[model samples]
Target: MIEVRDLTKRYGAERAVDRISFTVAPGEVLGFLGPNGAGKSTTMKVITGYLPPTEGTVLVDGLDVRRDALEIRRRIGYLPEHTPLYPDMPVSEYLAFVAAMRGIDASARASRTEAVVTRCGLADVLPKRIETLSKGYRQRVGLAQALIHDPEILVLDEPTTGLDPNQIVEIRELIRAIGREKTVILSTHILPEVQASCDRVLIIHRGRIVADGTPDDLQSRFSGLRRLSFGVRGPADRVAEVLSARTDLRIADVSDLDGETLFQLESDADTDARPLLFRLAVEEGWELTELHRDRANLEDVFRSLTSA
Candidate 1:
């Protein structure tokens, strides 16, 4: 539903977004990840028609963002990092005003306002002024304003920035539910938020996109090697002797606790040891208590991609 090709944005001599490219399909939620000053917000601004790219093109549902800004705006709901709100307006009144700005007719304003208020859980705050609401309620009001038009695509930047744990969970669940039928591009520094809410992720660094894939795929690609841990009830020397026969696996660490021995193995070679380990334990009369493989996670991937 969205495509960006070699998009670049510059301020004076510095390039904020350096020729980055990616795509988002319908019903897909893509997480945009980067550290501070990594051009995440710059890219979002270019895509949402808030700023024009210095080079390349951004397309929403096949409409060029630069050439068809109005049409693209009609289809996209943008919630910037700093949500612009009328502090003096009541929640319902503020949403109604935004709906009207989005071109809702006078007759349909009330229903449209009600729908977004319900969806964003702002019903309780309807009568309260935005300035009087809590941080969570204020965030909800921001989201309600964004969805007042029911846009096909949602571009949310740090949608849960200042909320409590409960409010964060609520917003995450709400975004996940909305993503079931629409395209979403979510930008955040919170890695776990991506794992919990996004179907895929794009990692940006130094003004360019460095990695793009599902979280599991990026983890596997960066892990490169596998590590395994095992615990057995046996003499440490005997356990070492038994494992020493397998030249394919590298014995990384070994320790003993009471009568039980723990083995840590690292191998670049792809070897399945379930059958061999089980049979060897049985033949040696050792009680094999635990065996497991450890793989890289999103944190590892992020560090590998972003570190200089």
Candidate 2:
């Protein structure tokens, strides 16, 4: 539903986004992740027609963003990091105003406003002025306006920022539900948020995409080596000797703890050494107690990609 081709954004001599290309399919929720100044927001701005790219092109549902800015905006519901809202307007009144701006007819404004109010959980705060609402309610109001027009795509930046845990979870659930029908590009630095709500992840760094794939895929790609940990009750020297004789396993660490020998094994390939280890222990009269493989997670992958 969205395609960005070799997109770049520059300010004076510095490039905020450099030759980045990616596509989002319909009904896909893409998590855009990056450290501060990694160009995540800059990319989103270009995609939503808020900022024009210095080079390359962006297409939304086959329409060029530059030439069809108005049409693209009509199909996109965007909640920027700093949500633009009329502080003095009541929640319902604000949504109605947004509906008008989106070109919704007067006859359909009330029902549209009510639908967004219900979807974003703004019923109790309908009569309250935006300025009088809490941060969570204010966020709800921002989301309500974004959805009041019922657009086909949603570009949300930091949608859960400043909300309490409960409010964050509520907003996450709402976004997940919305993703069931519309294409969503969620820009945030929260790793767990992506794991909890996004289908795929794009990690940007230094104005370029450093990683792109499902969270599990990226984890596997950059996980480097696998580590096998085991605890066996035996003579530490004898156990070490047997493990060292194997050409497949590279012993990373070995220590004697209590009455057992703990071994940390490493291998470049994704080989399962547990079965071999059990067989060796039985033949050597060693009592095997604990055996497991330690796999890399999303956080590990993120740190490896972004770390200097």
Expressed as tens digits, the lDDT of each residue in 1-308 for candidate 1 is: 89999999999899999998888998899999989789999999988999998999899889998799999998988999966678999887777777878898988888888788788888777899989988778778877877888888999988888889998998899999889978899898888888889899999998999999997788778755566788899877888886887777778889888878889876553566666777888999899987887643577678878988
Compared with the true structure, all predictions reach lDDT values of 0.85, 0.87
Best-fitting candidate, scored by lDDT = 2
Where does the lowest 10-residue lDDT sum fall in candidate 2?
294-303
Q: Which segments of model 1 are wrong by more than 4 Å?
A: 225-296
TM-score of each: 0.81, 0.80
Q: How many angstroms is residue 38 displaced in model 1 relative to the true structure, after the best TM-score fit? A: 0.7
